[model samples]
Target: MMIPLAPATIAAPFARYSHGVEVPAGWRLAVCSGQLGMASDGTVPESPREQADCCFANIAAILAEAQMTLTDIVRINAYVTDRAHMQGYMDSRDAHVGTPPPASTLMIVSGFTRPEFKVEIEVIAAAP
Candidate 1:
């Protein structure tokens, strides 16, 4: 099984995420490309929360193809267009991730390929 690490010496994580994750030997790993907040139908939602949800949904579909689920995720890297979108993204992330949530990083970026895109997410998952 994967291990979640949060050393006592270090400050606790700011949110629902582990400081780091230790993937065991002989496990299969899948790394997904950053997914934008666009739907399969090419629709982009105006709300940041809705867009974040779409990003997670896309990630889920990708993980499913590798016979893995979000629970197997070990790390997550997310980007938002502005600080205002942080909470929305965090809310969706908290809802989607499994227990002992994966190590995570969130950043505020200038923009994305499309102006309407508010969030982008990528993940690394490992399973035995």
Candidate 2:
């Protein structure tokens, strides 16, 4: 269930992601740190698309560790090293998210910890 918070005066939709409205007083919350596109061997994926996929995969892994699924996600923040791959990343995210896209933010950044890593993701999920 979507918890209503005090409305913000900002018009920018992306702000909804960066400054997520406060959850209801008693609602349970989950805070996940950003997930990078590193592999088991510490190797970063070569392409933006591949890195994006891995980044989401890692986020899913985090949620799973907490006994949750993507459906539990209420908000997400995505960082991409290449803006040119926005469409491709959107396609992949759409395919992976199923339906009713969660509130999200995608941004292009100058770099990540690893040179080959092209994307990173952070997620916020809630449960009653």
Candidate 3:
């Protein structure tokens, strides 16, 4: 089982995610490496919106490989190349992963491994 936590003390999360997550004992946990927006063909999208879409799509595929779903995700760490892309990032995230969201943190960085890569997302999931 997973318990999503958001203390009343801190400001509410900017979006759908919780501030923290607690996974109970006896369940298996899956920790995913950071995923970029690269597609199977080694193509990266041009716009932040497109990249965010592909990034989450990639995450879904990886979790499915481990027999998990988005609802099973307990935590996420997201990074965007520029602060200007924040809205697009959140929009894409909302379109992909909605209710029963994970505990998460989103950051803006100077750049990524590739200049065209605008977004990266990493997740932790738990299942019985």
lDDT of 3 by residue, 1-128 (tens): 57778788889887788888788889888888998988878898888888888877888888899898777888889999888888888888778764567788899999888788889989888888
Question: After superposing candidate 3, which stretches have Cα over 4 Å from the reference?
Answer: none
**Pairs with backbone N, CA or C atoms under 3 Å apart (clashes), candidate 3:** none
The alpha-carbon deviation from the true structure for residue 9 of candidate 1, after best TM-score superposition, in angstroms, is 0.5
Which digits, one per residue and each the tens of the lDDT, describe model 2 over residues 1-128? Answer: 55433356856453323234334456676778988877657777677677667777877888787787776677878888787867656665666662345678889999887677677788887766
TM-score of predicted model 3?
A: 0.90
Give each model's whole-structure lDDT: 0.94, 0.69, 0.83
Backbone clash pairs in model 3 (N, Cα, C under 3 Å; residues 3+ apart or in different chains), count: 0
The 10-residue segment of model 2 with minimum total lDDT is 14-23
Q: Lowest lDDT 10-mer window, candidate 3? A: 93-102
TM-score per candidate:
0.98, 0.74, 0.90
TM-score head-to-head 1 vs 3, winner? 1
Predicted model with the maximum lDDT:
1
Clashes in model 2: which pairs? none
lDDT of 1 by residue, 44-103 (tens): 999889999999999999999999998888999999999999999999999999988999
